[model samples]
Target: MSWVLGNLDVIGGHAGAHLLQALPAIVLAFVLALPVAKLAGRLGVLRGGISTAAALMYAIPSLPLFIVLPIVLGTSIRSMVNVIVALTLYGLALMVPAAIDAFRSVDGDVLRAATAQGYGPVARFWAVELPLAGPVLLAGLRVVVVSTVSLVTVGGVLGVPSLGMLFVDGFQRGITAEILAGIVLTAAIALALDGLLVLAGRALMPWASAGKAPAEPSPAGAPDPAAAAAGGAA
Candidate 1:
């Protein structure tokens, strides 16, 4: 705790920069993933290609990506941008597939009903599909957030002076406390974000099944005519 207090400046800077780097990727991936997911749902071609491409991005080792970016884009670019681009690319792989899965999990009957009611794509998405997909989106976002946290440390390895840099410094300096502080703090941040996503999903999709109903019929049965008819026939 004392060690963490001692490095408050460094820790805060790392947190701020990492957030800056991560926010853009999250927002960008989500916005772009929407259409891609929808299209993938509608046209089968996109599903394979998107999953493949995102997986390819994930396969690109971060160290190599760090090396390649400077050569292609050249240095003088901000560290934040580099982190954003890499994270965004990484996020696309996870987000696209997750979005597709979420969209697919949506009830087709509801979609057809919406279509019958003359709901357009955007309206239908907002009104019906997106709500139902909230849980899956949260699931994906949880993965993305955790991945971003881990990779920000990787970015620090490239002289990015991120949260990872703090760990690296602590390790190199043989300051066990600082290193421990970094690890604990990072885990806390990840847990906090993940919890928030879970809470938000629960709030947004209250209808999503979290548990089974109480193992009995409603105290006041709503009168099922089908059951009543069967009883009468007997």
Candidate 2:
């Protein structure tokens, strides 16, 4: 506790850096994933190939990838760019499939109706398809946000500035308070970001909250058709 109190500014700075790394990767991933997913959704032949490639990217061990990314991108190993690029790849790998699934999940009937109403491919996508896919797309965003937050901590292993540094420092000094503080703070940040995404999802899709009203019953003085039919049959 004393350690954390003493290092509050340091911890806050690291957390801010962690957000800086994560937020750009997340935003960029979503933007990139949308077009890829949309194309894959439209072209059946591309779906398997695209998904397999994303899966392969995701399957690579994060630490090794983090190390190799600097070499691949011609950046310094100590650079935050390495961490951002690595995390962005991961975000795209996860988000592409989610976006593809979201687009695929849109109702065929709605799509057909849109087409019948003379909506062109692009117009229908924005007006009909994208809006219908909102819930699932938001679900994917939540997953990406949480995953990115957690993964940013792993960058600390490579001396990248993040809350994960607390773990490294605490372990080196044998200070349990620093370790606990890092874990607690990381969890709190993840939860706060996840909650914000949920609220944003709700705000964007207000219709999702407006559930169907229950069917109304017949008027109290009205004759019961089911009972009348039953009595007639008897």
Candidate 3:
């Protein structure tokens, strides 16, 4: 408790830096993923190849990727750019499939109706398809945000600024408080980001929450005044 209180400034600063690294990567991944997803969905020949490449990139261990990225990109070993690039790759891996699935989940009949109503391809995609696909795409975004926040700690190993620095420092010096603070802070950040995304999704997709209206009362379920009148007459 005393350690955490003492290091509040350090923890907060690093947490801010952690978000700085993660949010941009997640945003970039979502933006870049749309086009990749569109191409993959439209081109059958490319779907498998694109998915496989994303999977392979994701499969590579984070630490090794961080170590190698500076060499490949010619950035400094401790460059935050390497961390951002690595995290962006991970976000892409997760988001591309989600985007493809979201787009595919739109009903064929609805699309046909949209086309028949004079909605051109681009117009349909923006006004109809994207709105309908919002729920699934937002779900993917939540996942990517949480995953990226957790992975940002790995950048600490490379001496990039983040909450992971606490972990590295704690482990080396055998300080339990620093380690616990890092773990708790990381979880808190992930949860906060996820909650914000959920709120954003709900705000943007009011229709999703507006479920079907109640059915009208059926004749069998309601008292039938005409039947009662006929029975009384009889």
Leading candidate by lDDT: 3
> What C-alpha lDDT does candidate 1 achieve relative to the native structure?
0.79
What overall lDDT goes with each candidate model?
A: 0.79, 0.89, 0.91
Superposing all C-alpha atoms, what RMSD in Å does each candidate have to the true structure?
4.3, 5.4, 4.8
Of the two candidates 2 and 3, the one with more favorable TM-score, higher being better, is 3
Per-residue lDDT, model 1, residue 177, is 82
Supply candidate 1's per-residue lDDT for 156. Answer: 70
| lDDT (10s digit) by residue, model 3, range 72-104 | 999998888999999999999999989988888
Ranking by TM-score: 3, 2, 1
Residue-wise C-alpha lDDT for candidate 2, range 121-159, written one tens digit per residue: 999989999999999988998888888888988899899
Off by over 4 Å in 2: 216-234
Clashing pairs in 3: none
Clash count for each candidate, listed in order shown = 0, 0, 0
Ranking by lDDT: 3, 2, 1
What range of 10 consecutive residues in model 1 has the weakest lDDT sum?
Answer: 214-223
**Cα RMSD of predicted structure 1:** 4.3
Task: Return the clash pairs for model 1, or none.
Answer: none
**Global fold similarity of model 2 (TM-score):** 0.89
